[model samples]
Target: MTLIDEGTAYGRQRQSHDAEIAEVGAGTPGGEFMRRYWHPIALSAKVDATPQNVRILGEDLVLFRDRKGRPGLLYPRCAHRGTTLFYGRVEDEGIRCCYHGWLFDVKGNCLDQPCEPENGRHKDKVRQPWYPVEELYGLVWAYMGPPNKKPVLTRWDTLESVKPGQKIVATGSSQGAGGDDTVEIVPTNWLNDWENIMDPFHVPILHTTFSGVQFVPEMGVMPEVTWETASHGMRYIAYRKLEDGRELDRITQALFPHTRIVPDIRLIEGPAAGVGWVVPVDDTHFRLFHARKVPEDFKPIEVRHYEGRKWSELTDAEKQMRPGDWEAQVGQGPISLHSEDHLVSSDQGVASLRRLLREQIRTVAQGGDPLGVTFDPARAVVKVQAGNYYRKK
Candidate 1:
């Protein structure tokens, strides 16, 4: 056969990223799907008492509280003089842009303008692009979707189970994982890291054995997992119980279009962490915002940025002594090459996840309701099989 024909015969099928549905971050089909719901925009600590500059889903936004203690989400630029709100002055009413002194509230209504006389009477005439925001589990969430479609603030049992005295802390990583208080930006596509939430199989290798043994042996046995569609562009997966009975059963939860309750393999008794994402920075890059709720006596989660070894970069010796997150998922490339992959029984969870995602895209295209679309009034407990797993090598 000719080279072109031969290549085609041996080539693999492209994934959603290869098509319009495939986007690395903002501006892709996947990103469009993700914007249909509320996404975590910043860690609560990042926006306290001061106007903070934030970016999510490729949109730059500001998270600030008005004088009435109401949180506001707005595009970073002020309508008055196109000033960056990061330098804006926080007031009892809202943030006042520094350039033209245009003041706005959480609802984006321009309240005052120093440049305009008449005590800023014409302020109401101008509107700043602001979205609705809510604080949950100490994180700020924003809805970038149509205002009519904005859903209510929500929490699963895993989050509700957390009390003030419990271990609830915000993630420092851009997408929230590494033990830092700073955000990290990837040079690749956003989907590359977002989809890592669904592929549970990678943990055992990339995170556990990839470095050395990040997870306990009992945590490594792969379990039966399945995925289903949720509202907007979200996907949910459930990992059933493992064969061993003594090991306490646990489920790690991931919400689409982007969010996750990062499993803590270090948990000796209860859960280890929780993480969620903000919007993508672009198709080739994205940022994350996360929080971890560790057990009451988990030794303060000593891991920080680079004081400890990262999963991504480690010498065999260094890796042997370190746990990893680097290789965990992002290594699938800035965006994964779905064609280069080979799935097996162990990967059923990821496979099921992709199928459900495609299914929902199809549903939305046909103007049908996707799962998790309606408001879950009761705020039920969301369970998914997540955590450590292994396949016989």
Candidate 2:
């Protein structure tokens, strides 16, 4: 892709991801559009021993765990002489730049500049190139939004789906489900995939037609799905429970700005019932991370190839493979063109998501509250009858 000239707006010239606006990212409005929330960078496990370099929102970063079991996110370079911090050593406090011994804490606070003044130091006066990071739901998240207004971390029922005891006592239980060690990344753009998490209407079509059947027989009965904003992104509460119509299906929720509570976890050798997270690498590229805890008898398997450079980097071949999402979004162009979109009633989920997104994005700009503002831990087995495949009349 050719670099857009300064002040030159760039986006899909054709029917893209319903997007045409340039100035959305970085110097453009597109980059600024993405700089509104906290983005996840790595699985918590990635922050051990050696530092891991990461790129998010077009910025380079370094990740590592401290000796005290604290994970840190820092600028890729040392403030001193601009040394790359990815080669830094993990210490009990934070990551220490291997060169000149400049130490920085997880928050990027310069702790020790050994080459500088001795006695207790003036390191606290300086800050290294870094951002605030938090470990939640088995991943390391960093806020690339504004220097302030970082939203509170929202929780999801899936994290508590399994009993704590089940985690410790279950024999040979795959810890990925209930534990905090498993996090996988699928490269793509945030909008293309994040929209999928909210729109369940695609499964019976895309997965069944293009890919293959991945849903249960009960899924054949697509029920009418109703959506509402909650402590999370949007809740697609199904009006129909199942094919049998007896048991009430629990609500499917997407935690804003990313992550979802899937009814199925792809635990078995086949795709199990599962939840997924769409993490932003930048406006153009992102990742899907799914941590599953399958049945003791189930074994999940799949293969993914990493051919792209970081989140902000994409080769033409990598661009073509944009994964399934690429075909869904970019094929439409840089942004999906809404003007050319002929949405049918089947696009209900997509309609709802877009409506809510437009609303929330406006709210965010006006300094108003976004969805999933303050979570209520009221767990209920609500009967959700979403649009499932029902036998036609």
Per-model TM-score, in order, reads 0.75, 0.69
Residues 256-359 of candidate 1 have per-residue lDDT tens digits of 55566556655444443465663466665666766566667665443432235433444556543553554334555666677667878766656656666666
The candidate 2 region of ten consecutive residues with least summed lDDT is 168-177
lDDT of 2: 0.56
Over 4 Å off, model 1: 1-16, 19-28, 162-167, 174-183, 219-250, 267-279, 291-299, 304-323, 366-369, 379-393
**Tens-digit per-residue lDDT, 147-250, candidate 2:** 65565554434344555333211111112211112323333455655566566565555444432343344444465666676644576755445444453333
lDDT for each candidate structure:
0.60, 0.56
Q: How many residue pairs clash in each candidate?
A: 25, 49
